[model samples]
Target: MRLSRYFLPILRETPKEAEIVSHRLMLRAGLVRQQAAGIYSWLPLGQRVLSRIERIVREEQDRAGAVEILMPTIQPADLWRESGRYDDYGKEMLRIVDRHERDMLYGPTNEEMVTEIFRSYVSSYKALPLNLYHIQWKFRDEVRPRFGVMRGREFLMKDAYSFDIDEAAARISYNKMFVAYLRTFARMGLTAIPMRAETGPIGGDLSHEFLVLAETGESGVYCHKDVLDQPVPGEGFDYSGDLDAAIAPWTAYYAATEDVHDQERFEREVPEDKRLHTRGIEVGQVFYFGTKYSAPMKATVAGPDGVERPVHSGSYGVGVSRLAGAIIEASHDDDGIIWPDSVAPFAVGLINLKPVDEATSAAAEGIYERLTKAGIDVLYDDVDNRAGAKFATMDLIGLPWQVIVGPKGIASGEVEIKRRATGERETLTIDAAINRLVAG
Candidate 1:
């Protein structure tokens, strides 16, 4: 995409309302604009990153045998009533009435709705181990919505529901999502520590929250240092097989968020040197609530013995929108957001240092074409702007690589390539630069 013809609204000054680095950088980098207190309109750059994150989440979910199916943003209140949580969900849920005077709500979560969907068509042990997921918008009217998208009222979320005939089968489904969450976060360049957490209104006895450690995180966490270096399972991991062994490595350690933190346990379990106390931002969570909704909503499936019973169910959630801010919190430096390669809005930033110069413009245009043709997402800054401004914008947006083209460099038949994460620069021939990027 050419910056000259693109819609990147880079902010020259940081907004006063931004309390943290991630929120400030998101605003300055032209990612999202606040539509209300906690609602936002994702701009071009933000939309690109959001879409990239969604792709990674979806791919990982698919690998774990979760089938994709989109659910509606609005859900019928009767579904929540059927699950005995219509009023118990509290003020966070936005209750509404339609013209027909029927009750409805902008769903905060889809537990009850999904249970209703499950009982509608699935009725036997044959479809027992089914997992369904969707990436969709959700609304939760936070009393004090702040910190940009990190605490937004309306956000995009990926929620997967797994249905099994019994508790043992449900555990298998839970482990699939647990292992999948580890791989998913790792693929996005994040080391997420799975911590025992309260299910809150979701109401599950077995629950784990995946958190990314950051100085600017929201919750205080305690864990053994060993979890920091735990290796994630590789791509060839057998999701079809029993995952209890794979899940054991992570569960062997003690990690808990403040909601469920036990100070005495932390002291007794972890050695003084191994005890890690810090802050973390929750990126995802997995829950196994045996017959929690199924029993109440009568979502039953016939067993092999021809007895009808409530299906054991689990819900796994990945914050599709909050992760954008969380990634910035974990990765950014003083300049701006340091996007991970997998979730970068654009892989390469091509800066035309002298857009007014014919030779420089031609060289940049050629390089941009080559990079684009090489299957790289390159944002070419072919606008007639000051070099410093161009560099600042590039740094603020934080693409993985920046290719600089100018008369001096073009005269040598080369361009300067700079790695965004490290301020390392190299001058390479146009062919060499293209080859290197393509190889990467």
Candidate 2:
């Protein structure tokens, strides 16, 4: 996208209400706009970043063998009543009545809705292990919504539901999601540790929350320092095979969120030198809520002997929108958000230092074409902005790389490339620059 033609509404000053770094930067960078007290309109640049994050989440879910199936954002009250959470869900559910007088609610989560979907077509143990997922928007009325998208009322979420014939089978499905979450966050350049967490309204005895430890996090967390060093499952990890061996290392260390944290136990389990007490942003969570929804909703499947029983189930969720804020919270420097290469809105920012200059424009334009043709997303700054302004914009938006084209560099048959994360600059011939970025 060329800056001149793009719709980035960059802000010169931070909004007064933005209490957190991510929230402040998001507004100033023109990634999002506040539409209401707790809702936001994701701007073009924000949409690009959000989509990239969603893609990685979907890819990892697919890699873990979950089939994609989108469900409705608004659900009938009858479904929730069947699962026994309609009234219990309280004011946060946004309960409403249709013109026809039927009750409905904007779904805060899809447990009841997914249960209905499961029972509608699935009726046999032959389909015992089925994991269905979707990337969609969800709404929950937080009384005080703050921190931009990090704690927004209406936000995007990637929620996956799994069904199995028994508790043992359900745990296996849970482990698959566990490994998938590890890869999802790792690919986004985050160190999200899976810690023991309360199930809360999700209704499960076995649950884990993936926390990206940062001082600015909302939840206080206690963990062993080594959990940060645990290796994430590789791309070649076999999802069909037993995952216990792969999961052992991650679960071997001690980690727990504040709700489930035990200070005495934390002291006993981890050595004093290895103990870590910090706050964490919850990015994702997995729950093995065996038959919680299925039993109440009659979502049962017939076993080998033709006797029907409730399907054991689990739910895994990733905060698709909140991740943008979380990534910024974890990775940003004083300049701006240091986007990880995998989730950057654009892979490269091509800066035309003097777009009004004929040679400079031609050089930058040529480089942009080459990069785009090489399957790279380049945000070319073709506007006639000053060099200082161009550099500041590049740094603020935090693209993984910046290719600076100027008359001097163009005359010397070179363009300067800057790595946004490290601010490392290298002057190379146009051909070499393209080759290096393409190879990446």
lDDT of 1 by residue, 342-415 (tens): 99999999999987889988888888888888889999998888889989999999999999998998999999
Candidate 1 Cα deviation (angstroms), residue 325: 0.5
Q: How close is candidate 2 to the true structure, as a TM-score?
A: 0.98
Clashing pairs in model 2, backbone N/Cα/C closer than 3 A? none
Model 2 worst lDDT run, 10 consecutive residues: 240-249
Q: Write the per-residue lDDT of candidate 2 for residues 1-440, one digit (tens) a residue.
A: 89889998989887999999999999999999999988999999999999999999999999899999999888999998988898788788899899999999999999999889899999999987999999999999998899899888998999999999999899999999999999999999999999999999889899999999888888999999998898898989998787898888889988999999899899999999999999999999999999889998999999999999999999999999999999999888888889999999999999998878998888888999989998999999999878898888888999999999999999998999999999899999999999989987
Off by over 4 Å in 2: none
